[model samples]
Target: MEVENEEPSWFVYLVRTSKSALYCGITNDLQRRFKQHQEGKGAKALRGKGPLQLVWSQSEINKSEALKTEIAIKKLRKVQKEHLVKQAVRFDRK
Candidate 1:
């Protein structure tokens, strides 16, 4: 039997492309993932979508939760995602 990984080091991140498109994904190493995306080696959709900016990230979550959050973000409409980015930043700045 396989044991569950309860380590809460995973994160869900939102990347904004140069074209103003938002991409949601989960990763444990945010910087590494961002580098891969920049090099066109991360998500196929993000390929050629250079100049990605990490607009939002939620960390200290386990892998399962990160995956779930990624899906939830993906299912949201563009406007909703934008609103999420906006809201996520407000707390950090204040």
Candidate 2:
């Protein structure tokens, strides 16, 4: 048996709901979590908000940092969250 050495990673993500609302969360497996949300099996606020689109994801973070970041983002108003997402997009393009 062989063990593959893969660095653990945490991510903070934002998704756009079918109704155009934003959803934010933290996950070690962004793809899986995103799929769960899209399938209506994730967050209660996200259920029935199908056709979700992953809009922003921040990687290279640890669990603690991710949790704190998630908490901070969750506390933001809708406009503030939108600003955060825009910042992420700009950062990614750099």
Candidate 3:
């Protein structure tokens, strides 16, 4: 018998709160992460404002890159984040 890998290839993502706030995070499973936020079990700051809507996400080849990306995103201001999201959308359209 062969073992199958069910895990997602790690990702760094951003979720948009109902108030239009951007939340930066990293996770291997986007769906599970989204569910956790929805249940108010994710980040403390996000607890009351969720169920968050996934606004952007990008997969990385490894955990280190994912963490780096998460940190970079977390450092951005709201305007920068919006620019990033727009860039991502443009990239995806290509």
Candidate 4:
């Protein structure tokens, strides 16, 4: 048995729904997660809200940071999230 030394890079992502709503989530596998969202397979809130777009994403973060950042972003108002998307600000920090 062996262990891989490198850790998976987690990401905090914001998706824009067809109805102008933002969905926040964190994943180590960004591509796969986004695919699930697009297919309406993950996040019940986004199931009926089709045509999602990956508006913003911050990469190269650890799982802990990604989860924390997702929570913080989820707590923000819509306007604030739009501002974040507009700015594409790097908010994840140690």
Q: Which sections of candidate 1 miss by over 4 Å?
A: 1-7, 89-94
Top candidate when judged by TM-score against the true structure: 4
Q: How well does candidate 4 match the true structure in TM-score terms?
A: 0.84
lDDT of 3 by residue, 5-81 (tens): 64548888888888999988888888998889989988887988865788898887678777877887777678988
TM-scores for every predicted model: 0.81, 0.79, 0.80, 0.84
Order the candidate numbers by lDDT, best to worst: 4, 1, 2, 3
| Residue-by-residue lDDT tens digits, candidate 1, 1-94 | 9988766698888999999999988899999998999999999989888788999888744787777777877887999889879888421211
What do the candidate models score in CA lDDT, each in turn? 0.83, 0.81, 0.80, 0.87
Is 2 or 4 the stronger prediction by lDDT?
4
- What is candidate 4's lDDT per residue for 14-89, written digit by digit as tens? 9999999899998888899999999888899899888899999987448987888888888888998998899989
Against the true structure, whose lDDT is highest?
A: 4
Q: Which regions of candidate 4 are displaced past 4 Å? A: 1-8, 92-94
lDDT for each residue of candidate 2 in 1-94, tens digit (9 for 90 to 100): 9987656598888999888899889899999999889788899999988789998888744798778777877887898778877777422211
- Candidate 2: give the clashing pairs: none
Evaluated at residue 67, the lDDT of candidate 3 is 84
List residue ranges in candidate 3 displaced over 4 A: 1-8, 89-94
TM-score, candidate 3, is 0.80
lDDT of 4: 0.87
